[model samples]
Target: MYELRDKDFIFIFTGPNGAGRKTVAQMSGETLGMKQVISYTTRAPRSAEFNGQDYHFVSRDVFTEAERNNEFIEVIEIDGNRYGVKERDVAQMIEKHGAIYLVLNRFGAEALKKLYGNKAVRIFIYADLKTIVKREEDRGDTPELIQRYTSHYDEEMAYKDQCEHIFENLDLAHTVFDLTKTLDDNYLHRNLVDKD
Candidate 1:
């Protein structure tokens, strides 16, 4: 197991579907020089998503086998597809980068927070239902998928208060700017405290 320092932050970004959580997390991580933690998923890749970059796409059998082996730190099933982060992968990233960000669902975020305590910073990025629907449609999501995601909007929203930060992602550029600024400030503060 990799030792965790107080200064090592695990940023967990989560929100309802089509809320732009992934994009915001990726952009903010890039700007802040934090490593992005790619999760393993049994779901098929989206049109623009790649096997390695976006997610380690795998078959259900493979995912089940990994789960049986206790390879995952946290796992959740959404829309009948399983997604999880490997424990070894997270330890490697933290060993290399000190800080890392992950785009996860509410369950996964909660699990990480429980494991890491305050070192886990949860950020909930969300938009209005109309905006979410529009974004999903623009992304060419099927009607069934769109409906399934939107139906869980309220449930996901209920988890917002459990997060450390909540942001309305109406504009991509502004959201990224705000997210990165907050992260940078926190990182600097943690380092300063560590030095003292």
Candidate 2:
């Protein structure tokens, strides 16, 4: 088996709503001093979202232009909006260290895995349905949006099936602890060691 190292390894975290992959990405980004490749999208900005930080809001025309220029590492249209990670953002981080990660939905990650082969680690994040409702509520999602997200939970859970490793996210510290433990083991699966 290929050894997983803190550096020179990319981790892909996938899971259903409230599964906390985004939370891991944010935490890992801070831990590694890595800049997130905030995606560009055609959707209207949410009340809490800002330009060039959470996401790079762009007109559909501009997004299309950028994609045509081959500026994106990966791009996809979802829910009638175009979203993508630019190639330059990914390249800069990777050029410095091989430890870079992309938090993607099912489609993007699947395609990337196919193209890149075994270079990336797939970490699936998941939680029970009750956890999902609370997590979404904690984010201040409205009753209606929460209900909609809840309804789609099945689709999200399906994403976990594709991952090689699975994590049940309970909180920020809990998830980080798991990741750090993985680091301690030199990134090998813990079955190689005895745990009481």
Using TM-score, give the best candidate's number.
Answer: 1
Q: What is the C-alpha lDDT of each candidate?
A: 0.88, 0.70
Model 1 lDDT-worst window of ten: 187-196
Candidate 2 runs further than 4 Å off: 1-7, 32-35, 183-196
How does each model score on TM-score? 0.92, 0.79
**Alpha-carbon shift of residue 28 in model 1 (angstroms):** 0.5
Clashing pairs in 1: none
Q: Candidate 1 residues 1-196, lDDT tens each?
A: 5679866889999989889998998887877778988999999998889988999999999999999999999888887889999989888998888999898889999999988888889999999999999999998989987998798899899999999999999999989877777777766353222221
lDDT for model 1: 0.88
How far residue 154's Cα lies from its native spot in candidate 2, in Å, is: 1.4
Cα lDDT over the full model 2: 0.70
- Model 2 lDDT per residue over 1-196, tens place: 2333345556666677567777787785565444555678898886667898767899999999999998876788766888887767655766675566777777667765765567666777788999889878888999887886577578777877678777888877878667645643554333333243
